[model samples]
Target chain A: MSARPRDPMLPRSYRIESVESELPGGEVFSWTLRPRGGELEVGQPGQFNMLYQLGIGEVPISISALGEDGTLIHTIRDVGGVTRNMAALSAGEEIGVRGPFGTAWPVAAAEGHDVLLVAGGIGLAPLRPVIHHVLANRERYRRIFLLYGTRQPADILFRKELERWRGRFDIDVAVTVDRADASWRGDVGVVTRLIERGGFDPRNSIAMVCGPEVMMRFAVMSLERRGVPARQIYLSMERNMQCAVGYCGHCQYGGHFICKDGPVFPYDRLEPLFDVREL
Target chain B: MDDLAQVFAEEPFFSGFSDAQLRRLAGLARPEVYQNGRYLIRQNGSADRFMLITTGHVVLKAFVPQRGMVPLETLGPGDPLGWSWLAPPYKWHYDGRALERTEVIAFEAEGLRQAMEQDHELGYRLQKRMIEVIAHRLQAARLQSLDLYGNPAGDLP
Candidate 1:
């Protein structure tokens, strides 16, 4: 909860306290980082941080969860050389960390309404914290729904946590996959389709959606069809963020700098530019 | 029959039908229930009927040679199941099973086909709705086939 450092670009040295495999084949990992210098800068739900891999590179990864003892939990997919290298790092290895940056999900503002979280693939990582916050304040929200869809049963993230959440009577969690083999017994479809079956009161609900741009566009369309207003819906945008502080112009969308102005924005704010392909 | 007509009138699928059309269609429908794990339609079986799911879930699955049943999609309340009944050779391509005790307003495809042939307006309206359902499902299937979530570019920040 502390303020960011005076020089936003100055990356802090943090040692990886633990490295856990989040998915099979070690394609994805959850790394818990502890600041070697001081306390961890815990990010709000939907906020991302710039993780520097020494001389290699830095990529912006959303904070997946906050460890109980103040460590930062980041769920990362090994898609690039930097992420692949980071996955190879063992516990006690040091990496540069900056931010906890960008706008956050309006979890507090959504207190009195039905909270619907729609995620696809790795998009679930950013929304996991919002789920934790809502569950922690269970009584404040009327209903909470998490609709997630991934590529396959094998690609599902947070399997145990999803099962545990499903066990709770207060929250509704529906998981689906685009495809599955014979052994899988779950729903098979795009994440957007789950919106229709979510059974939330869209009129009084606030929806937070995160996924690929195409998936998010379809999700927004589905939410709108269910009567959720543009103002009540939020989306997390991903862009190439070289400088996490917005100086680089690498993550600009129209006039908004994703790093500072948003990684999260109300649907209404982006309506004009959302469907424009060349942006 | 009046009660069945009311049910059809209330369903989204039958939304624009006239009162007379609903009454005629209702004559072809009868209520059916399947308990959990019951097979609603077996693969290669005659697709003699289609249903308007009133409650519970139906999973459409295809059987693999060495593997077991692989689920293709799950349809629930307000969803219409089985379009194969409208086409020739009317055979189910996949098996539809109830994941829970399911209630549906089952329509006799043979009777409906006869009625449609007699009443062209009713046939056109019904066929249009079915086409919409088919188009929507086709679009969803295309999106699913893309494996959009599996695209590595989705992870790039």
Candidate 2:
């Protein structure tokens, strides 16, 4: 028998309101979406959507930000078959949408604590919404620190936004590049080094990190070294997610389904499962 | 107090050094500057001097067969430049190039070595700090060589 009508498993149509190339290379882009109906709604900071191109494939991308005007932002890197199709399309094109699925960054619980957002490369996409939320409710958090690391000056994303955030009195942002050329004046090293430069009250700090698993591992280690407990750190994990609703085991790790249970999890919960290498 | 000693007294690399110790070390140091594109030290060159950078930055680089002058690490103001002088052979392992208009407090390796030999206390503190810097750079190289971003598992490009 077929599944019931209006099934959560079924995809909904959403129009690509606009798309901006994220870098000069044109491999990555930030797409703004407007849903055709109430079928799929923008979810939480760390939640994701399964974007389906009619003739191609469907892939998961995090909701980078929920625009004040009600549009959803997705920063996608052109990778496998599906994303390539989505990136080549122009405005006014319709793409399939399903969810703002999975758990979100613990912004609510992080209130009243010093917030540290550590992101690497495209990892910044999933954490951008958290940054917007904290700024909107600036009075709730004690202090906000953002430490972002990318490959080089050429790979930096949202350049203007980073400059704006860097100018804010309340937000402390540190950026590092893996390598630097003649014109690059910023710190040239790993992002973890910024944890030491960032002045956060570790006892009252809650760190949210989104990056390559390798980078996040070191990030958590550095946070722990700085006296922030493991439970106080959260990271967003990326895996091959097919079903947004956890039915397919494509995104399973250590008996936990990344689709339903989390894309964000406390460092303590992920510690043993992380570094498992393709598990 | 000498201006160089005053600066050294406040730097992290020279932390734990008493004002008296800073003054003693500063005597063997001279001010030096390098323009952009100049090499502070070349690989295999005799490490006659070690430096404490005061302004601008220098990059540690190595020349691979196929890659020309690949940058390994960058050292900014308040960072130390050469550790090869502290070890035997006393030859640099990489090229240090000025990334900008760099100002440095250069210490004669022979003079500092003699001073350390005479003052065990000063030698112990300075040696420990140099070891830490060396260890840090070694770890950075290891991490960078991993190429964490190039093939990050599950990360989309």
lDDT of 1 by residue, A1-279 (tens): 997546788899999999989889988899999999777887899999999999899999999998889799999988987898888899999999989899999999999999999999999999999999999999999999999999999988999999999999999999989888766667877887788775789889999999888888888988997899999999999989888788999999999999999999999999999978888
Candidate 1, residues B40-80, lDDT tens digits: the string is: 99999999998999999888999988878888888889889
Error of 1 at B56 (Å): 2.2
Find the 10 residues in a row with the least total lDDT in model 2 chain A.
A179-188
Off by over 4 Å in 2: A1-6, B1-58, B61-71, B76-79, B91-108, B115-128, B151-157
Interface RMSD of each: 2.4, 3.5
DockQ of 1: 0.57
TM-score of candidate 2 chain A against the true chain A: 0.96
Tell me how far the alpha carbon of residue A138 in candidate 2 is from the true structure, in angstroms, after superposition. 2.9
Error (Å) of candidate 2 at residue B110 is 3.4
Q: How high is the lDDT of residue A18 in model 1?
A: 92
**Number of the top candidate by lDDT?**
1
Every prediction: chain A TM-score: 0.97, 0.96
